[model samples]
Target: MPESTRERGRVEASRGGSVRLEDVAVRFRTKKKDVTALRDVSLDVAEGEFVAIVGPSGCGKSTLLKLVAGLLKPSSGAVRLRGEPVTGPRHDIGYVFQRAALLEWRSARRNILLQAEMRRMPADRARARTAELIAMTGLTGFEDAYPHELSGGMQQRVALCRALLHEPPVLLMDEPFGALDALTREQLNVELNRIWRETRTTVLLVTHSIAEAAYLADRIVVMTDRPGTVAEVIDVGLPDERDYAVTMARPEFARATARIRDLLGAASAAD
Candidate 1:
């Protein structure tokens, strides 16, 4: 893609302008009860914006991503991507979970190519895209390595590569780096931010780490306890090109993280 086109792809938007959710609620029914997971939740993630969702355990953080992916239906209200209502599983979005979930038998490159196989992408096109992603994600040397041969962080990199193979407009990440050790997680956070900037793909990340959210997101959505509802949405107000060490030391980072921590603490108390 041309540089100008890539720059235009990063354009931001007002709330409810891109990915829109209007008074959404999710309920799960069991034999004995109808359990509410989310209630009256409304949020909008602007195009090319990096948004992070944080809340107490069981606040349906992961469920929110599922809604966007159209993996689950809302019991009330609506979930829309761009302008259209999400009625079923959306193939245009990329999703990554906490675990890499890579096929043990597949090499790193082959694992990423799995996305191409499923999508039936042209062989040359898929290989080119996979190569670009491998280089972009610092996985160049490990392409032939199997999952067990790579580190946890490396495995997650492969998962991210697969997720981005199609270059979807929106990426949904559910604690993609949560399982890594502190050092690895921090490293991946930096890489993720860089990747987002380069690709200009909108991202919605669900995480428990205040620092991680503060570091990566353009906006942070803090939620209440179970029956998850938006408590507050904070604009991070950081430059797109972020230096990890410098960013963590900034007052904006400190303030954002502090408020998120406070909100989570309050939610825990209520729970």
Candidate 2:
């Protein structure tokens, strides 16, 4: 949770633009049988806070994100935004997937404007937002560039710009850079830290990389396997003002990284 809302006691994440999941359990009814992807999963991300979820594969990390996004309904628990039930897709929360998912035919600028178009934003305002996004994400010169013309990192930057075009208060990222190379992923981590600070958007990121989660998240939420639940929530006590090289050198960062790894190891062994 961010310092701004710690006093409010996890209210924003569960009740408002800040996302919350309350004892949420989701079961899928497939043709063969019923599968419980998640059970008793509860979490809160305070306003302006960045939380990352890390766990073994099939831990329902994505399902948890979808619940908050209103793309999936919990069978036994509740998901709330601004104190209202999230029954369907919402425009106020933005999502970034593992892939850039940009249209092949559209240029970077047009791809960004696509969000505004879907939301029926005014043409003048959409153009203004598009320009601002292009500048902010360092796509100023490549506004006319198509997806293939850009590198993996650049493509993801455009995807991020599109996600943030409307300035949604809460941003949900599902391994947005999982497909990138190690060096590119490291560079984007730095960029993302800066962007998150500048935008001050509440973020909940699901990642497979412990190092990546430690670098970018304020709190790390560890989950159990299969019928997933919150195994632990570890605060990344390192300084908020973080840079890639220096932050990685800090003792606190090392401690956080090690502790999370141990917890995950323990979780794995228990299985």
lDDT of each: 0.91, 0.86
* The 10-residue segment with the lowest total lDDT in model 1: 1-10
Cα RMSD, each candidate? 4.5, 2.7
Q: Residue 103 deviation, candidate 1, in Å?
A: 1.2
The sequence of per-residue lDDT tens digits that candidate 2 reaches over residues 54-151 is: 99999999998888888888999889765667899877988999999999999998998899999999999989988887887778899999999999
Q: What TM-score does each of the candidates earn?
A: 0.94, 0.93
| Best by the lDDT measure | 1
Lowest summed lDDT window (length 10), candidate 2: 1-10
**Per-residue accuracy of model 1 over 25-142 as CA lDDT, tens digit each:** 9999999998899998888777888899999889999999999999999999999997778999999999999999999999999999999999999999999999999999999899
What TM-score quantifies how close candidate 1 is to the native fold?
0.94
Residue 24 C-alpha lDDT in model 2: 90
lDDT of 1: 0.91
Model 2: how far residue 40 lies from native, Å: 0.5
